[model samples]
Structure formats: C-alpha cells, structure tokens
Target chain A: MSNEHTAGPHSVGRRLIDLVPHIVLIVGVLIFAFPIYVTLIGSTWDAATIGRGSLPMTPGGEAWTNYSQAWSESHGERASYTPVRLMLMNSLIMALSIAVGKIAISILSAYAVAFFRFPLRMVFFWMIFITLMLPVEVRIIPTYKVVADLGMIDSYAGLAIPLIASATATLLFRQFFLTIPDELVEAAKIDGAGPLRFFFDILLPLSKTNIAALFVILFIYGWNQYLWPLLVTNSADMETIVIGITKMIGTGEAANDWNLIMATTVMAMLPPVAVVVFMQRWFIKGLVDSEK
Target chain B: MQRRVIFDNKLLPYLLLAPQVAVTLIFFIWPASQAVWQSVHIQDAFGLRSEFVWFENFTAILSDPNYVGTLRITAVFSLSVAVLSMAVALLLAALADAKIKGAAVYKTLLIWPYALAPAVAAVLWMFIFNPEIGSLGRLLNAMGYNWDYRLNGDQALTMVILAASWKQVSYNFIFFLAGLQAIPRSVLEAANIDGAGPVRRFWTITFPLLSPTTFFLLVVDMVYAFCETFGTIHALTHGGPGKATETLIFRVYQDGVVNNDLGASSAQSVLLMVILIVLTTIQFRFVERKVHYS
Candidate 1:
C-alpha cells in the first residue's frame, strides 16, 4: 500500500484530521513526562522554596548541595538515616544477584528438562511451574518464618534467594530450548560431546539473546521489589533505594526535605529507567515473550 | 513438545535441577503448605499456645466487615486501575499506531514509566499532590477545593488509584501497540478500499481482531493491580484515612505483620492464592488456545 492511498488528497479539513494523532500523542507524552520533569526541577531547588507552595517550574541553583547531601548523609529527622549511596549499593547487589541467580538456575533446569530424560522429569517441571501461583506477597508470613528459621533474616540472601525461584524465567528458557533442533544434539553426540559440553558449546551461545533480554526484565523486577525488602530488611543498611525513598518522606510531613528526597528519587529511578530506555528492544521482547 | 533426540543422563539432570527445585521446595512449596496449615490452626496472641480451629479463621475473615470492605475496595481499585490505564494506553497506542512522525520517540518516552517502582511513583505523585508542598495540590486549594488526600478517605483512594494507573499505563501501551501492529495491513487497506471510514474500520475490523490482546491485558492488569499495588498504597496513603484504601493484600500485611494475627493472615493468603490460581489457569488456557490458533 502506498502512502497516497491512506493520505488521500489533503484538503485543509483533512489535513487537520491527520494532525489529530500527533496532537493526542503529544498531550499523552506530556502527561507522562510531566511527573519526572517536576521531580527533576524539584531536585534542583531547596526545601524552603518547595515548602512555600506553587512549586517552581524552572531548575534552581541548589542541585550540587541537594545531591551531595542526599548521596552522603541523611538530612531529614527520620528514625532510620541510611545514606542513599548505601541504599543504591544494596539495590544494585540485590538486583544483580536476583537477575544472575534466576538466569543461572533457570537455564540449568531448563537445559536439564529439555535435553535429558530422567525419572520424575515432568514432576520436577511441575513443581517449579506450580510456583507461578505463589507470589511472595501471598505467602509472606510463612516465607518470612522460613527465612527467620534459616537465620537469613536481615541478610542479602534473604533479600534475593526467596525471590529467585522463578517459574517464568525457567518456562521462558525451557520454551526457547525446545525450539532448538534435535539435529544439533545429534551432531554433538556423534562428535562424542557430552551433555554438559554440548550445553556449554551450543546451548549457552544460542541463548545469549534470551539471557540478555531476561536479565533486563529480571533486573528491573528485582530493583523495584518493595514489600519483600520492606519486610525482610530490618537494618537500615539493607534497605533498597525504593524503600529508602519512602522512608525519607516520613509520613508526608512539611518538615521533610523535599529537594533531597527528589534527588534520591531521581537516583533510584535512574538505573532501571536507563536500562529499559537503552535496551528498549530486548526489554520489550523479554517482557512480551516471557508473559506469553 | 519434547525434543526427539535427548541426552540419556540420569544423575546429572537431578544435579542440574537441584538449585531451582531446592529453592522452590524450600521457599515456595513449603511456605505455601504452611499457609494452608496455619489457616486451619489458630495461634494465641502470645508466643506459646496454639489450637486447631477448623474453618474458624476462614469464617472469621469472611464474616468480618472490614475484610468484606477490603474485598470491595480491591475490586474497585483493580478495576479502576485496569480500566483507566488500559483506556489511556489504548488511546495513546492507537494514536501512535497511525502513520505519524516521531511515533518512535513518543513510544520511548511513554514506556520508561514502567521502570519506575510503584513506591517511587507514589512518592512522585505525593510530591505533586501533598497539599503542603505539592504544586498541583496547592493549585487545587487555590481553586477553593479541599484537596487533602491525607485527611479524606475518598481523596486518598483517588490519589493511590491515579498513581498506580500512571505507572501501569506504559506496560499496557506496549502490549496494545504490539497488538495493533500485528494486524495485517492488507486487511485494513481492504477496509479502507471498501469505503469504510477510519472510525468505522477501527470499530469493525481493528477492535475485533484486537480482542485477544485486550483479554490478555485485562487479566494481566487485574493481577498486577491486586498483587503489585501494595507499595503504591503503602507509600501514598498507608491504606488509611480510616481503612478506605486498604485492599486485600494490604490488609493481609496489616493482619499478618503488624497485628500478629497469623491465622487470619494465612487464611487471607490462601484466599489470594485461590484467586491467583484461577487467574493463572485462565491466562494459560487462553495462551494455549492462542498458540493453537497461530
């Protein structure tokens, strides 16, 4: 189909009709961008300016002071005073551990289920698959009990380990591995290559795209985790940036440092948003494909 | 769909599956079973006594007015979020799907909000609507409207819903856009050639074709609203202004963690599991049918 067929002979009225999509889309984009824009501008201003309502639309001159204060020390008179730097580091560790751990174990299990015929193979697969119904929130209490029993509470393992038993990633990898041709396995067999070798040499290389895609999704999932970290992490040192920012707000009091909190919010959102924006294609692929 | 030629390994497969299976069994299976067990068994307030109470906890939860209120709130909240987000997303997606300049830029700009945490999104909105320091809130007050979410239950519910829906629009937009793109252009072109206007063609040809994606998103969005909006509610209103915004999930947290009411919380959790299982089964069945059709 040529563009002219859709475009038609453009009368003035027809041209105005054609502009509707752009107009609506621009409005939608502005609505979506406005919050972040406000946050960005708010981060640059001091608390006193923000507190005296009618927030300034323009960036202020306190960007350096606000960011430095937020990054290093706790400014608000909150109970817990963990620095944003420590919280960001904690979030990074948790996110990385979850993404890497989920991928590693899921791929292994997927490889095993795809390549080898063993006793109770379907049983094992179903065991993992059944977990799709059990989110951390549903079984929060019992899971916390189990973690406490294992003495993993307030630890990094507690933060990430309970989250890594992912049915979706395993299912995603398993689905991908099933599409690999049997001829490759046969060729490897004829060459006296063992299962592990074939996996290392063939399967791992083939799964690179899926791995990277899943990593982006899982990393964001890990970073954005709120309830689990809020429950498990007792010490301020173990706080993720997401929970940390909320703590800094401290009941929405006027005494709260709005500028510093906004700065921390920016820092908190930077990594995951950057990942999604930079790896847009893979992130979309991973999300859509994994859900399917 | 098992592979034709497979490895004949026995011990290695178990070894390979150990970590995932171990985690699932220890964390997921065991805790889930414990939830079931705890729902049936009641515990005293202190750390000492316990009693086997069959269906008592379940009955208590079902009979509680607050639980029922939470159930209603969850229904309203999830439906509003799903409808609001999906509606906005569909509009934006339809506009972007048109042959327009800078569609890609609009999509990139629109989709980044999906990366923001629900808590962070709540905080952003809180900053915007905080009545004290919030620009919009101040504007609303200046317009002679009482716009304090912190003091009013209805306002609190509205604020949380807006924040939650704002964060979720990007996700639904991506899916809706993908669904729109997957329609064969020839079919649309034929519709255009048949003298059908754009609006008519959209209603007749486009929407029916998009139903599968629409159905899929509805279920996904409902699940997201039910399970994932905890942070938004927590940060924005703390399920407060007198239990107005407390969804089932938030109520579970309150009963479980804060009040130390383990039995009631476990019962609630089991109910949520049933809800999730039903949703998951529906989703999987629809997906399988979709796969067969494709």
Candidate 2:
C-alpha cells in the first residue's frame, strides 16, 4: 500500500481511475432515478398540460388539485370509479394481511417440520416446497376456480389468502429453525415447557429478527402483486391501488388523465418503497438469506 | 438435519401444519393437478363435456406456429432482460465497489426500485415513453421518428423489455455488490502488485470469483423475466401490436381468461411448469454443490 504513494509517474492515471467510479455511478443513479423524477414531477402538473403533450419538466401549481382529484373523485372513464384512498386502504389491508398471514402460517409449519417428529412430515414439507414451481401464473385458472368455489372472490380473503401461502417464507423459517441450538430445546423440555409454550415464548422471541426481515420482503411482495388482485377483484371497491392505476389509464392515451394517473402511481408506490427504504437493512438481509 | 430433541405430540404437528398444508393443497397442488389433468383432456366449445385426449393438446400447441413464435419471443425477451439487467447491474455494482465516498447513498438510491411492482414500473416507464405525453416519446416524435408502442410492435417489445429490465436491475445489483464485496481485497491488491490493471484483475479474478453469484442470479433473473414480467407486459403492451410482446405466461393469461380456452391454457401452463421445474432443478443442483464446496 505504501509503495503506491511514492510513484509520481502513475499519479495522474491513479487519479483518473479514482474518478471513473464516481462518474459512472452518478450516471447510473441518475438513470435509475429519472423515471421516478419524471413521474413525480408529472403528478403535480395539471391534466391539460400533460394532455397537450408538452413535457413539463418543472413542477406545476396543481399539486393539490391533481392529488385531490386522484384521491377523491373517480374519473368518468369507468362506470364505477374507486377512490384512490379506498384503493390505498385496500392495498394496505391486502399487503399487511399477506405479510402477517404468511408469517403466522409459515412459522408454525416450519416449527412442525423442524422440531416435531411426525408422520408424512417430509411429505408435507415437499408438498409446500412443490408450490414454488407452480406459480399462480402457471395454475391461475384452476386457482381462480378454487377461490371462486370457496366463495372468496371480491373479498379481501380472495385477494390475500391464496397469495399468502408462501413456500419461500416457510423455507426461510425452516432454515432458521434448523440453526437453533438443540440444547435450547432440551432445556425447554426440562423446564416442563410444552411445544406451544416453547414456541410462543422462546422460539418466537428468538425469531424476532428473522420475522422482521421476512416481513419487509413479504409486505413488498404483497403490495407489488398486480395480476392476482387484478384477477380476483372485479368490483371497484375491491380494486387495489396498483390495479386501479392501470385501469385508470385505459387502452388509449386520449381519454386517460395523465396527471391523475401519475399521481396515483406515486401513491401506489409510496408505501412499498417506504418499507424498502426504511427497513433496508432487513430487506437486504432477508433477500440475500432467502436466496441462499 | 433432523433434530435430536424433538417434540413427540401426535396431533400437534398436524395441527401446526394444517394452515400451510391446507392452503398448499387447495391453492397450489389441486390447481396444479387440475392444470395437468385439463392439459391431457379436451373440452367441447359448449363448456359441457370433456374427453381424455392424452398429448393431443400438447401436439396442437406444438403444431401451432403462433405458439412457436411465442416460445421464441419468450426466449428472446427473457435472455435480453437477463443479459441487459445483469450487465448493467454488474457494472454499477463494480463502480460502487470501488473506494468511493457516499457509496452508501448510491446503493440506497439504487435498490428501492426493487420495491416497485412490475405493473407500477411499466406504468412509470409508460409515462416516459408514451409516444405522446412522455417527454422522451414526444421528443422522438417531434424528431420525425414514428414512435408509438401501441402502433409499433418492435417499439412495444422494446418498451416492455426496458421496463422489465429496469425493475430487475436493482435485484441483480444487490447480489452483485454482495459478491464483489465478498472477494478478498488482498487478492486484488496482490494482483495489482503483479502488474495487473483493473480490467484485467476484474476479468481474471473478480469476475471468475463472482461466477457463483452470477450463475445464481442468471437462473433467478431468467425465471423472473418469464413469470414476473407478466405484470409489465400486461400493463404496458397487453401482448400488444399484434402479439409481438406476448411471453408464455402472458399468453397463458390471454388464452385462459380472455379467450376462454381452458384446455389450451392449461397445456401452456403445464409446459411453463416443466420449464420452471428444469430451471429450478438445475439451480438447486448448483446451489447444493456450492453449499458443499463452501
């Protein structure tokens, strides 16, 4: 390391080498942020400005008007319009339900698979694991049929439950459970703690970090879901913000409210991106660990 | 990996496993089996009766030139997305890996796009390349470039690819950063001592060392492009401009939902399932080998 400091001949090249990373990274960051910047700027402008096809790079005075229109009134395009607020609430419910539902179900299942001696345990585990291959897109028709038969359509249950059954979550929990020291379990047994007691007390507390990490991923996963929600909910009130924003756009660009649509886009992305940015460490940890 | 000290409750484990097992059975296994069964059978157009016709639907789909074209489109789309996203992410990750100030800021800014839904991502990109209201779109059109994704098939495909790759690059960036950071700094320093430039050191040392991560990301990204990009395609193109951007999964949605051909859709679903199984199996094998080696 010290040898490089004595070299005056290579100083210019080394300085250039140091500058290269900053230059490329700045360009990369700008490109990554450009769409977001454009959308954010578009959200504040009036529809007519956007409708006239003039690119408004600067913020407009219609921030309140555009946001209020997007949030309150259902534009006349669709017969029934869902208020963006209701859709946001619906998205929040669906995402939170999915995240909590998956964590609850998967933890118990992973507990059983990891800690209990039971018949067909591997069968149950493999059955859960096989779901990974059969993504809803592959089996969506039949899955929709099943949900319809269960009379869950147009309900929050329909939107969240089928998607909540997560193999990745179960696998993650199971892997974490396996790494728990056996002596802890033996000590729990000696303490006269039953399975449920140990699970609710010791095991749950031990899994706090994993649960938090998984929550970030699962919540984002739930919030970002488009097709499932699109398929299950035919009604306006049941529409998620993600689906509603797309529906607002319609097919052609002529009738669509560009300002309002961009506003809704910003609203739709807010919660999930906030989750990722706030819980970034956990999200990254969960992602890397789960992929492992 | 069985636990030495295990719970010995007979009914309790079943009780614990009930929710996941039941959901899996109803939502995943049953539907998947139904897809398989429906693929092997043909239903009448009247939605009344069906007959067992083993391999007939598969044969029909194989014989269909449109289906073959879809397969090719999917291959091209998936490969392009994977390559473009990975290359871009790898470059950004490498740049970030260099000793730079505010690297943390760079990473934080780069990764949040991972949280954007594919549909939302498509909508964001659509705003920019809308060929009318989009700034870039308006710029291109003003310059006499006939640019309408809704009208141009190739343009539509490009739009969808860019959107999909945009959404995915963050994921690959995170992984690549991890892989690069895991490389021993000492090794790179030693290479520098041996007269290797940065490019040579990266290719010979950093890249080879990062292959495991790269391989894993390749499989993951391919699968992502196949399945997850459905939202992007559905929102941006809807298999648009005469089915130019239709991937397999989107085709499955179009056929089953819009066209109402249950049997054919199920056949397509089954084919997708097979492809995924193969990809996943290869991934698992490589992962297991990596685990053993480590």
Candidate 3:
C-alpha cells in the first residue's frame, strides 16, 4: 500500500488530486461539528440573546451563570424542576449498573453454555438469543406493567435491571469463549482447580479486553436510553439527563430557558462522547464484532 | 460449538444461568407474552373490566387509517434515513480510505457523534432550527421560507429525519470505514494495472465487494430508524403537526402510555414485534450467507 504511493514520480496534477480527500474530509468534519458548535456557543449566552433571534456564533459572558443555574435549578417554567446535577448522577448510575450487570450475567451465561454440558442448555441459549429481536420499545407497555407489578418503578433497579439482560453481550462472550483452546481447561483440571476457580483465574483474565470493549458499547447504550427511563420514572428526582433535557424544552419555546437547556444538552453529551473518544479503539471493535 | 474438555456439573451450569434466565423470563419473555395476550384482549380504560376478543385488535389496527398512515410514515422515514446516512457515510469513508494524511484524526472527530444520545441530537438540531431563536430557522424566515417546524408537517418530518440521520451517520461511518478498509488493496491494484480508471474500478470492484457490508448496514440503519429514532421524534416533533411524523413505534407509545389505550397499543406492539422478527431473520440469513462466502 505504501510502496504504490512512493513508486511514482509526483506530478502536479497528481498532487492536486491527492488533496481532494483532505478537502472533502475537512468539509465533512465541519458540517458534522456545526450543530455541536452552535449549541456550545448558545450555552454561553443569556436567554435574551438566544431568544432575540439570530444566535451569535461567538461565546458570550453568561457561561458560568447558565451552567450554574442549569446545574442547580429547574429549567422549564411549567415543568418539574429536576436539577441537572441529580439527573447526571442518575444517568451515571444507570449506565454503570447496566454495563456491569450485563457483562457479569452474560459472561456467566456464556460460560455455562460454552463450557458445561447441562440439561436444557440449547433451550437456554435459544431463549437468550431470541431476545435480540425484542427491543424495549417494542414491548414498552407490558414491560412497564411488569415493573409496576414488581413495585420497581421510580427506583434505580427499575431503571437498569430490565435493561441489563443483553443478547449481544452473551453472544459476544460465547463466541470468544469458543475460540479459547481446550488445553487451558485441561491445565486448570491438572492444577486441581474447581470450575469457579478456573473461571476466576483463567477465563476472567482472558476476557478482560472483550469485557472492556463491551463496557464501552453498553455504557453508551445505557446512557442514551430514553423511552424506558421515561416510562419507568414518574418522579423528577429519578429523571435521566437525556429525558430531563427534553422536558426542559417542554411544550413551548417562550416559557423555557434556552441557555440553561443548551448547557444541559452539552453536559448530557459530554460523558458518552468523552468515553467514545477516549476508548475509541475498543468502541469500534465492540461495535463491529458485536454485529458479527 | 462447545469446548472439548468441559465442566460436567449440572447444578453449576443452571446456577450460573439462573440470573440471565430469570431476567430474560421476567423482563423479556414474560412481557412479550403479555403483549401477545393483551393484543387479543380488549380492556376498558379504567383497568376495571376486560374481555377476550381474539384477532379483533389486530383487525382494527390493520383497518385503522391512522395506523396505515403511520405505517407509510415509518417506511418512508426508515428508508430515507438509511439511504441518506449510508450514502454520506460511504462517501466520507471512501475518501478517508484514500490514504490521506490526518485520516485518524478525521475519523476520531467523525465517529464521536455515535455516542451522542438521539434525544440530545434532537436538542442540538432543534436549537439550530428553532423558529424564533434558532439561527438557521431565523435565516429561513428571513428568506420568506416561513420555516416553522412546529406548525408545518412537512417541515417537521424533514427536521426529524435530518436530526435522526445526523445522529446515525457516525455509526454508519464507522461500519462503512471498516468495510472499506477490509477490502484488499490487491484487487484495486489489479484493476488499476488493467488501465481501468478509478471511478470504473470503484463501481466494478469496490462496490460489489462492499455489498455485504452495505446490505448489513441497510438492515441496521432501517432498524435504527424504525425503533431507535423514537427519542429524536419525541423530542423534536412529538410525532406532530397532527400525526404527520408519527412512526409505528411512536404510535404505540402514544396509544399505550400517553393515551392509556392498552388494547390498541398492545396490538401495535405485537405487529412491531413481527416486523422486527422479520428484519432480524433477514439480517441473520444475510450474515450466514456472508459467512459461507468468506
């Protein structure tokens, strides 16, 4: 690949042609970044500046005021005043719990299916695999009813538990486990290790990269959940930042604080975006591998 | 695909499987069955009385004009998003695959939007397109476009579609880029040595090879538009200008949660499940075919 580019004498026309990709990519990047740029600038201004039409492209003097207010106070005039701080905390907890819970349960289930000969193993595998077809939105009402019946609504368990069962994670782990050599199991047995001990010392250590990659994907998924959290949490204290930001917009633009909402939107995007950017290699691997 | 040497304990496997199986039954399998059951029953609004009316809810939903409209809207919305996002991502991916400088930096910048929540994506676009305060919205109004998505159905649908597609591009970009990268340079170089131009070579060589990835992404993008874009629609338009942007999933939510029309909602849920099942089957079949080819 590198030799092809270096083998030829560089012509002026060829040099110009080589520049096309860079120019196109820059334009693409700018267009993609435009919305976030606008929102960031808007978050720094007072509501009056934003509301008066023609939002300034430059940052204003109200950054501290807007962020502080959005962080501590209610946003919409008519809506419930769920502080962004609490909502961020709720979102954090929900994302972490869902990521960790899904990984833990899925690894166990995958280990069982891959390493053990048990009754109804295929049935259990099929049962878990079939869930890839049933998204939360499709079964919203009945799922809501189940949670309500269990008296789990408005709680963290309600927020995360129903969502923690993941077909993708299970399948990923199962696929990974199958690729492990049989010699490891024999070695563990020769060392007088029990099933749990082998799993802890051998399998768990081997699965670290897969687990981290899956964590990045699941964390974003859990954080971005809107409808499930919307249905289950009736109280303001339990509101996720994603749902909270929308509620801040409310029904009308006139009664809302645009700057505060913008600040919250920026804050809402920060963690997940940071995770993807920082853990990009794992995120990409998990996304591509999970689909396969 | 089991291990050669394995754990023989029956109780340990079940115990290990207990948590996942329990959650799947309680949350997934049970609610799914309930959706099926509720679909066949007509319940009064108050949860007071109910009657088993098999196939009646399905018949009514199928006959309802609003449901039909929603079905059309969903098809249009899903296809538009899939095509638009995939096209843009493919173009960008092709360019990024061109051995250009700063490709890694450009990729990092582009793929970060995959992490943005759909609802947050909606908020960002809504801020830009908000009629009174939004910069672009104000510009449109200034140009006598009368661009208020709040009052205009077409404008609302367009806005919702753009926002949804925007959020989805990074995801498609990552997959497309990977797909493009996966293609062997030897194939393209062979075509190049044959005096075939870049465009002809791309169409004849690159596209056919990329079809499996394209097909996979098509299903994924469609599924995304169908169900996952609920937050985008809910936040941006709330399926309004009088149900203009109401996709099938939003209608289910509207009927079930917002309106408390349980019977209709459950019927819709059942139908949606069937649609998703069909989509999943198609995806799996294609995946299996691809695996065999490889």
Expressed as tens digits, the lDDT of each residue in A1-292 for candidate 2 is 6776776437888778788888888898898899999999988887778777785788888788878877888573333357899999999999999999999999999999999988898999898888887778778899999999999999999999998788888999999998988999999999999999999999999999999999999899899887799899998889999899888887847546787888889999999999999999999999998887
Question: lDDT by residue for model 3 over B1-294, one digit each (tens)?
Answer: 688999789689999999999999999999999999989999776888889998999999999999999999999999999999999998898888887788999999899999999888988888888888888888899999889999999999999889999999999999989888889899899998898977798799998999999999999999999889999999999999899999999999999998999889999999999999999999999998987887
Please provide TM-scores, in order, for all candidate models, with all chains considered together.
0.98, 0.97, 0.97
Which is the winner by DockQ between candidate 1 and candidate 2? 1
* Evaluation by DockQ, superior candidate among 2 and 3: 3
**Tens-digit lDDT string for candidate 3 (A1-292):** 5655764538676788788788889998998899999999989987777878757788899899888888987554344458889999999999999999999999999999999997799999999999999999999999999999999999999999999898999999999999988888898898999999999999999999999999999999999999999999999899999998888888647546888888899999999999999999999999998999
Q: Largest lDDT belongs to which candidate?
A: 1
Q: Which ten residues in a row have the lowest lDDT in candidate 2 chain A?
A: A74-83
Q: Per-residue CA lDDT of candidate 1, range B208-288, in tens?
A: 999999999999999999989999999989999899999999999999999989999999999999999999899999999
lDDT order, best first, reads: 1, 3, 2
User: Interface RMSD (Å) of model 3?
Assistant: 0.8
How does residue B221 of candidate 2 score in lDDT? 95
When summed lDDT is taken over every stretch of 10 residues in candidate 3 chain A, the lowest stretch is A73-82
Ranking of all candidate structures by their DockQ, best first? 1, 3, 2
Clashing residue pairs in candidate 3 are none
lDDT of 1: 0.92
- TM-score of chain B in each prediction: 0.98, 0.98, 0.97
Looking at model 2, give its docking quality level: high
